[model samples]
Target chain A: MSLVEVTGLTKVFRRPVKDPGFRGALRHLVSPRYRDVTAVERVDLRIEPGEAVAYVGPNGAGKSTTVKLLTGIIVPTSGEVRVAGLSPHRDRIANARQVGVLFGQRSQLWWDLPVRESFTLLRDMYGVPDSLYRARMKRFDEVLDLGSILPVVARKLSLGQRMRADLAAALLHGPRIAYLDEPTIGLDIAVRDRVREFLRQLRDEGTTIMLTTHDLGDIEDVCERLVIIDRGRVIYDGSLAAVKDDFARERRIHLQLASPVPLASLSDRLPDAVVVAGDEPGEFTVTVDRFRQTAGAVISAVLPLAEVVELRIDEPAIEDVIRKVYAGELRLA
Target chain B: MMEYEADFWLLVLAGLLQQLVGLAFLGAVFAQVQALHGWTFTEAVLLYGFASFVFGMSPLFFDGLWRTAWLVNQGDLDYALVRPYPVMLQVSGSYVGLQGAGDVVVATCMIGWALSRADISWSPLTVLVGAVLLVSAVTIRVSVLAASCAISFWLQAPHSGFAFAINQLGTLGRYPLTIFGVALRGVLTVVIPFAFTAYFPVSWLLDPGRYWWAAIVTPLVAAYSLILGVRIYHRGVRRYESAGH
Candidate 1:
C-alpha cells in the first residue's frame, strides 16, 4: 500500500466579500457577502514509501493548499487524504507523528526563544527518545552546521541560518514522510545547494519526500518524480527524465566562426535544426531536438562549414518548461 | 520574556498600579458610606480580588490565546497544527505574560487581607469549598477568553477586538451584581458568564444562605465554559483557510 494517498480531494474557501470605503464597510456590517474559491478540486495522488516527488506550480496554483491538506493543517471541503493509513484530518495527531512539515515562508521556531529551545520543545512534543534525539542533533549539526545558531534567538538568525534551524526542527522526530514546501525559497546559492544536498541525503535514508518548490535546481538535484499542478489540478505526473525527454528536448548550440559565413549554407547542411543568425556575422545558433540530433553532431556539422573559435550549448532548462506550462502554452497530455 | 526585562517590569507595574487605584476607589467609596447595596468594603474587595486573580491567571499561563487573531491572520498557526500535541494547548502555551505576575501578587494580597477582615466561619469543609470555588473561577475566566478569542478564526482581524470587548466585560465582575440592572446581571450570569469567575462564588462564600446554589453552580458553569471554549476553538480551526504561500 502507498504511504500517502489522496483521492478526489477538494478544498473550497468561502472568502468574505467586502466593498470599498466606509459606506461599503457599513453596508457589510449589516449583511456580509462571501464567494467560494475552489483552491483544490478533485485531485488524486498516491505516493509509495521512499519516493521523492517534486510538486511544482505557479503562485496560487493550489500547491500549498494541497500540502496543507496532506499535512492536516487544514481540512478539505470534500474528499479523502490518508498519510500512513491514518486519515490526515480525522486523526491529525496520529498522522502528525508520521510526517514532518516545513513551510519555507514561515518559521516553526519560537520567535523570542533560542533555537535550541525550539528544538528541545519539538523533541519533547514528538516524544523522541533522548539517545536518538542527541544522535539526530549531532547529525544535523554535521550537515546543517546548526551549532553556531543553536544559542542564537530565532529572530536574530539570518535567513540561511533560520532555514537550517527550521529544517532541523521539522525533522527532529525522524518522521517517515517530510512535506517541505519551498524549503529553498529565498536562500543564497550556497545555502540552497546545502539544503538540496540535505534533502537528497534524507531521501536516501528511505524517507518519503513531497517537495513543493519553484526552484528548478531543487527538482533536478533532489527529485526523481515530477508532479506539475496548475489551477488546482495536476497537469502532469511522470518521471523527471520522461518529462525532459518529451517536453524539454529543445537544445541550442551557439557557435562563433573565425570568419563571416552565409546563413543559407549552414541552413542547407542542418535541415532538421533551425539555424538562426547571432549578433555578429561570424556567430550563429543551431536549435536542435536532442532525439533527432546531438549537440556534438551540430558542432561537427558546423566545424566543417567554418573554423570554430568559440562554442557553447544552451541546455534545455526545466524552468522554461514549467513557465510554458504555467502560461498555458504547453499541453502535457 | 526576560529578553525585554524593562517592558516586562513596566507592564507588571501598570497592572499593580491599576489594581491599587481600584482599591483606593473602593476605600474612598466605603469612607463615604458604611456599604454600597448592603455589601461592606471588605466584601467588595474580596469580590474585586477574585476577579483580578482569575484575570491574572490567563496572562500567566494562557496569554497565548490573546494572539489567536494575529496568528490566524498571518497563518502562523500552521506550524502548531502540524505538531503532534493538541493545537489548543500549543496555542495557549505559545506565550507567557510576565506582567501578570504583578496582578497575581496584588490580588493575592487583597484576597488574604479581605478574608482575614471579613466575617466567615473557620472549618475544613469551608476551606475545601473555597479552594474548589477559587479554581473554578480561574477556569471560567480562561475558558471564556479562549472561546472569545477563537472568534478570530472567522473574523480575520489582526487584533482580537471581539475577545477584547469580552474581556472588558470582566471588569463588571469586580463589582456587585446587585448594583447592575437585571438584563446585564443576566448577561454576566448566563450569556458570557463573567459572574461565575468572581461575583457568584464570592457572594456564595460571604452569605451561603442567600446564594447557596452558587457553590454547585460555579463548578458546573466552569465545566460548561471549558466545553464551550474547546468546542468553539476546534470548530474554528477546522474552518481556518491558511494564508497565501
Candidate 2:
C-alpha cells in the first residue's frame, strides 16, 4: 500500500468582495458579498515508502494549499487524504506522529525563544523520549552543524541558519514521512548544497520525502520522481530521467572554428541538425536530436567546411523540460 | 526572558500603580458618602479587590488568548494545529504575562485591609468557603476572556477587539450590583456573569444570611463558563482558514 494517498482533493477559498472607497466600505458593511476561488481542484497523488517526489509549480498554483491539507493544517473541501491509513484532518494526532513538515517561507521556531529551547519544547510536545531526543539532536548537530547556533534566538539567526534549525526541529521525532516545501530557497550555493546533501541522506535512510521547490538542483540531487503542477492541476508526473528523456531530447553543440563559416553552408551540410551563428564570427552552434543524430556525426559534417579549434556539447537538463512546460511550448500527458 | 527581567518588573509595577490609583478614587468616593448602594465602604473595596484579583489571574496563565487575532491573521496557528496536544491549551500556554504579579499583590493587600475593617466573624468554615469562591471567581474570569478572544478566528483581525471590549466590562464589577439599573444588573449576573467574579461572591461573604445562595452557585457558574469557552474555541478552530494562499 502507498504510504500517502490523496484522491480527488480540492480546496475552494472564499474571499469577501468589497468595492473601493469609504462609501463602498460602508455599503459593504450593510450588505456583504463574497466570491469563491478554487485553489485546488480534484488532484490525485500517491507516494510509496522510501520514495522522494519533487512537487514543483509556479506561484499561486496551490502547492502550499495541498501541503497544508496533507499536514492537517487546513481541511480539504472535498475528496480524501490518508497518511499511514489514517485521515490527517480527522485523526490529526496520529497523523502528526507519522509526518514531519517544513515550510521554507515560514519558520516554526518560537520567535522569542532560542533554538535549543524551541527544540526542547517540540520534544516535549511530541512526547519524544529523552534518550531518543538526545540521539537525534546529536545526529542533527553532526550533519547540520547545529551546535554553533543552538543558543541564538530564532529572530536573530540568518536565513541559512534558521533553515538548518527548522530542519532539525521538523525531524526531531523521527517521522516516517517528511514534507519539505522550498527547503533550499534563498540560500547561497554552499548552504543549498548542504541542505540538498542532508535531504539525500534522509531519503537514503528510508524516509519518504515530498519536496516542493523551484530550484531544479534540489530535485536532481534528492528526488527520483517529478510532479509538475500548473494552475492547480498536475500537468506532468513521472520519473526525473523520463521527463528529461521524453521532453528534453534536443542537445546543443557549440564549435569554435579557426575561420569564419557561412551559417547557410553549415545548415546545408548537416541537414538533420539546426545550425545557428554563435557569439563570434568564427563560432557556430548546431542543435540536434540526440536519438536522430550523434555529436560525432555533426562534428564530422562540420569539420570539412571549417577547421575546428574547440567544441563543446551540452545535454538538455530537467530545467529545460520544466521551462518548456511552463511556457506552454510543450504539453505532457 | 532573562534579558527582559527589568522590563517585566516595570510592567508589574505599572499594573500595581494603576490599581492603586483606582483604589484611591474609590476611597475619595467613600469619604463623600456613607455608602454607594446599601453596601459599606469596606464592602465595596472587597468587591473591587476581588474583581481585580480574578482579572489579574487571567493574564498570568491564559495571556496567549490575547494573541489569537495575530496568530489567526498570520497563519502561525498552523504549527499548533499539527501538534499532539489540544490546540487551546497550546495557545493559552504560549505566553506568560508577568504584570499579573503586581495585580495579584495589590489585590491581596486591598482584600486584607477590607476584611479587617468589615464586621464579619472568622471561622474555619468561612475560610474554606472563601477559598472556594476565590477559585471559582478566577476560573470564571479566565474562561470569559478566553471565549471572547476566540472570536478572532471569525473576525480574522490581528488584535482581539472583542476581547478588549469584554475586558472593559470588568470595571462594572468593581461596584455593588444594587447601584446599576435592573437591566444592567441582569446583564452582569446572567448575560456575561461578571457579577459572579466579584459582586455575588463578595456579597455572599459579607452577609451570608441574605446571599448564601450566591456562594453555593459560584461553582456552577465557573463550570458553565469553562464549558462555553472550550466549546467556542473548538468551533472557532474548525472555522480557521490559514491567512494566505
Best by DockQ: 1
lDDT of 2 by residue, B104-220 (tens): 899988899999999997889889989999999988888888899999988998988789998888779888888889998998889888989988888888888898898789989
lDDT of 1 by residue, A68-93 (tens): 99999999889999888899878989
Model 2: residues with Cα > 4 Å off, grouped in runs: A259-265, A300-307, B117-125
- The Cα error of candidate 1 at residue A38, in Å, is 1.8
State the displacement of the C-alpha of residue A293, model 2, in Å, after optimal TM-score superposition: 3.1
Model 2's lDDT to the true fold? 0.90
Clashes of 2: 0
Docking class of 1: medium
Write the residue-wise lDDT of candidate 2 on A208-304 in tens digits: 9999999999999999999988888888889999988888899999999999988998899998888889889989888999989999899899889
Query: Least lDDT summed over 10 consecutive residues: which range in candidate 1 chain B?
Result: B236-245
Candidate 1 chain A weakest lDDT stretch, 10 residues = A296-305
Stretches of candidate 1 exceeding 4 Å from the true structure: A17-32, A258-261, A299-309, B209-211
